[model samples]
Target: MNACIVLCLALTAFLANAVAQYETCVADTAIVTGGTPGVTVSIGRDEANEMVQITLVGPSDVWFGHGFDGLVMANNYGFIVDTSGVSERRFGTGYSVPTELATTSIVGTPETSIVGGDRTVVIERPYSATDA
Candidate 1:
């Protein structure tokens, strides 16, 4: 009976590790014409160490001049909890490039993929008066 308990524990640990082993990194792009230009984003598992990483390449010559305002949304993807059974539906945002490209990372614990299957990386450019 004791052996069976140990086996169960071992199995649990194995599954936990397996689930933790999945990681993903993806690079996406967003086009801006008027207001908040966004890009179609997709993130999938690659290796075990890096769950998800997203890169946004700005449109050519799409300069912010001063800076850029951007936000990343990971609404729903997969893996809500980790081995210890903790809420993992994490969401984050940040700034991107400066007169060039823009990028942000919605980093989370256990390295889970970004949520909201069809992730949208929105780049809210600083309103330019001269262009209009």
Candidate 2:
């Protein structure tokens, strides 16, 4: 009887962990840089279901925060970029919220910055079936 009870408890724990899994995945090559060393940074796609989360990571400088000011999230596709400080940084996936599937391709290019240590800016967007 004790062995059976233990087995049931183990099964329940496994099921609980499975249910708590996050639906997002980090992209393989999400970071992109621009001219100079710390002028522009971008992250491509961090997808989960039909939603993609992108983030811009950068160092602590005045110029860094200025680059990623007018960032936008698209239902189709978009980008966030940052480049303002001394430290070399990148943009990539952070976390994502759920979103509906996108019908058309949307494009955006917004920039922002972070001071102090390094920072990451995030945006979640949707995509079509083919593009995903």
Candidate 3:
């Protein structure tokens, strides 16, 4: 099992007062191995968009996604980063329903210099109300 490192910053009052001041919310990194080789997953939050950003560094053909809960089944919502440098917002009960989230500034350049290559994906969603 990969160890997920999560860093969360809660500033509801501060954010409400100073939306212009963006701060780091959550930052995490994990080493995942099972399917399609092993990949390093770095997750964080963009205070500006109040969304979670995910970066997957792995083989060129590897696909990566993450859900809210530990459950890997359907009915879960997550994002998929493909080798084609495309990010899809996926959700379903048994399978996956993929939709384009943000086409322009969502995906970052692939780091081909690395052993496998890395892709960054930004997820746009409101921050969780409750601090888990």
The CA lDDT of each predicted structure is: 0.32, 0.40, 0.47
Candidate 2 overall lDDT versus native:
0.40
- The better candidate by TM-score, 1 or 2, is 2
Clashes of each: 9, 10, 2
Candidate 1 matches the true fold with a TM-score of 0.22
TM-score of each: 0.22, 0.31, 0.45
lDDT of 2 at 88: 17
List model 3 lDDT by residue over 1-132, tens digit each: 123222223345556766433344434444323434454555566566565555555445566665444455355444555656544453556555544444333434433333425544434334542211
Query: What's the lDDT for candidate 3?
Result: 0.47
Q: Which ten residues in a row have the lowest lDDT in candidate 2?
A: 84-93
Ranking the candidates on TM-score from highest down gives: 3, 2, 1
Error of 3 at 102 (Å): 9.8
lDDT of 2 by residue, 1-132 (tens): 999999999999999866422344434232334323443333354233454445545554433322222242222233323353122122223445423224423333333345666565544445443433
Give the best candidate by lDDT.
Answer: 3
Write model 1 residue lDDT over 28-128, tens digit each, in one string.
Answer: 42322443353333345535353433333222333211112333332222122222322212233334221211322234422223344322232212112
Tally clashes: model 1. Answer: 9
Candidates 1 and 3 compared by lDDT, better number: 3
Q: List where candidate 3 sits over 4 angstroms from the true fold.
A: 1-28, 31-37, 46-51, 95-132
